[model samples]
Target chain A: MLRFIDARCMLGERCIIREGDPNTKEAILELMDRCHIEKAIVYHAMARESELPAGNMALIGETAGDDRFIRQWCALPSYFGEYMSAEDFFDAMKQHHVTSMRLLPKTCGYSLRPHSIGKLMDLAAQCHMPVFIDLGTELTTDESYDLCKMYPEVDLVFGNSGYRENRRLGPILEQCPNFYLGTGNYVAHCGIKLFCEYYGAERLIFDTGLPTGSATAAVSLIGYAEISDEEKALIAHGNIERLLGEVRL
Target chain B: MDFRELVYGQKPFEGVFVFDVHGHIGFEQGSQLGPNDGESMVHTMDRMGVDGICVSFSPGIRGAWKRGNDQTKDTCKRLPGRVFGYAVPNPFHAECDLTPYFEEDLGFRGVKIHGNIQGETPENDPRYAHAFELANRLKLPVLFHAWMPYEVDRAADVASRYPDLNVIIGHGGLTFARDRAVAACKRYDNVFCDTAISSAPDGSIEWLVDKVGVEKVLYGSDMSFFDCIHTLGKLALAKLSDTDKEKILGLNAKKIFDL
Candidate 1:
């Protein structure tokens, strides 16, 4: 089954515009049309920064109804009970057919610094789900890598990778297993080579934002990428399929 | 993963000898290197299909000398062939200027100083000017971390006096804010703009390439951290000829640094 995931590179709770970017729903359909992506996992800033995870919850709930896509919610583990109790989180996921969770510990100013939300994270792992976050910042790389290494059972994906810092990843990925990558910030120059060389194709997934840089443009280089077809399939479809396969959405 | 192979068949990148004028390695935060380092950066060169790079350490002085030096130095020692070095000279460090930066540092080819941009300088400090002259005599290109519109005069003065020296104005001088990079490049032939931070302010890289010619524009992923991808990738969207693309990517820095 060929499928595409909307990695949600950028979304404004309010409208912020890139010259060629499309709106949320339209962007996804265009991305699917362009790349033959049948399914996409969506992320949004409005949901992420909500006073409650309610915004994220609502989006997931709405999208879960669509067979063409899966809804992923942002869980502020640090702000847990306040935003939504763990029970509410479960309820929302179950209610909306939410398949996964995305975390933004740094941007949300939450402390993934060992001292905060230990139990909550452990509980999420018990539920068996994936956590996707934008690791575009410097600190998040170490933290994400370290955290994944620490919690081998937990599945994590880092989007908006620091392209130039691709070299630093080999050691980190070598140390941290069970980690995956989403490319919203990938460029043509040596980006595919770097990702394939160091991280292995098993971990790379196509998650570029739609419309503005829809899968057509986003996956163009990816389609022409030199990695093996099986490997490319994993990046293009398989890995993400397996990622969702684990969750009961 | 040779650069030629990666960029092959890519028509928009037809320019010969595109110089990655503003390449960097080394960490930025609190690690042995801060955020990104040379070793960590090498793979990206292959990924971006970059032919070669003139590397610098990560951004900010690490708030400590021992840490900062190690971060910058380690990149030079390890990736001599794959990368070039730029010393982060904090001129305020009264005792040590960029002298050792000239000699003894074998692999390192140039020097970069970031002042006030990190809340460190008053822009007109004499000692900073001394560092500029040191780079001049050493034939090392200097990338200073001071913005324009506010500090245009400072950049202009340095470039005019050291017309023979290659002084790149880091960060597009407000990316063509009030001082405007195009006007600045026109004013001083010796001065170049590091596109790392300049980027497409109003019209994208097309405007910069149009205004200053690709030779004066260089690619910088400032500390690179997470921002380098977008910084360098912006060029891909530019509507320049292939020859121009090569110049902006690596050849310009090659010509300037004589690499």
Candidate 2:
């Protein structure tokens, strides 16, 4: 029996313009149930609080109650002071087994500290935590390339890098070897075919960014695009397995 | 396949004009909308079944320019049979003597105005009045970028002034009220409502047809920015006949834009 997986699924809504919408968890699960996604790492949108690690921990706590999925630590830098002395960052990383910090410097209005970034990288090195940064912000996709280059070991998943002209990202794909992309919204854009062909298909992963019915729709984009099933299987699950290594589940 | 065939399964979809009404051309390369190159829009129009459109953008043209007309010259040259591009003018660009450009250069049949996207209050801006006057003189319609609780009053004010000018209030369905568009259309003969992004739970097409005549309504799917097929699916559940659907789908736009 073979099981497929979506490594980059977020537990929260991806749209920044409007709020009060439902998060991506139920939507992701429903889309996954419809499209068959197993073993997704979900995050929370309720991280506006001062103590974001606590907010993230609360999400982890909520999902700890559920059997179908697992929650990732969504760290807000404002909450970093509460728990982030490199030691505490590792403690939370170990406790929550956080694979990513959903970075939002423009929306969160914070700096990625030299001290924090180094220690965050150390924890990522120690615990293998990858950070998912939404490139939908004011930061250009080329800037996303810079961020990925700065911390090459810590896997950076670029989301909403640009809506259609995502092909501009082709140069970055050629330059940055370790960087990966969150595939939901990206696949819908017309240039996705060339992107998969140019960048190794393994460098891409599927995401719903769900609650916008994006996950389910995105599945079809990957399913129907000119790419082969072998490449899609890598994007859908194999690449995630390679990144995270063997886990108990 | 041709535009009619792409949408309606055949050509000679008699007297049908499927106007996208809302479109963007020339978004910068590697940006969200592909590139600002010559070939982008022609490729988009062919794939989307958009026969004609009145386009405006968040960018592409500088603030104090007729970005709409700037985009029009290229779209017409590229997809001559498939598109009739609209000349977009904002209050900032002071070109009162646009008749020559309208007739000679751009050959635009209509005008597109985006108020909210540019972060302006069109009601207070007198520069738009100049645009309205030019449209009236040319016997051309104006399809305005609008939404209720934001740009409704501006739409009504312009529509009331030029009774013959076909003023299309782009997104008029109030998520709250049923009679708002009806009351506005009743107030002005030129004003007509487009059932756009307001294709939500409350503002259904049946409610719009009940408020305004079927002739007054036009269908538009905000593609690239929205899922076109899914949006078309939403209207499939509306309480209207196949003819009503056909008219809304293409015929009404044909009549409205004179395609």
lDDT of 2 by residue, B114-170 (tens): 766445646426766777788877667787666654466677777777766787766
- Angstrom error of the Cα, residue A40, model 1: value is 4.8
Candidate 2 chain B lowest-lDDT run of ten: B1-10
Local accuracy of candidate 1 as per-residue lDDT tens digits, B24-49: 45443432222355655565555444
True contacts kept of 2: 0.10
The candidate scoring highest on TM-score is 2
Leading candidate by lDDT? 1
Can you give the DockQ of every candidate in the order shown?
0.07, 0.10
Candidate 1 docking classification: incorrect
Please give the CA lDDT of all the candidate structures: 0.59, 0.57
lDDT of 2 at B112: 72
How does chain B score by TM in each prediction?
0.80, 0.78
lDDT of 1 by residue, A1-249 (tens): 334455544343534543333555655465365445667777555765554355675575556456766677777663433666656676677777777877766656776644664554665677767777677552456677777766677777777664444555667778777777776555524466557876688878787644334344345445545466677677877888787787743
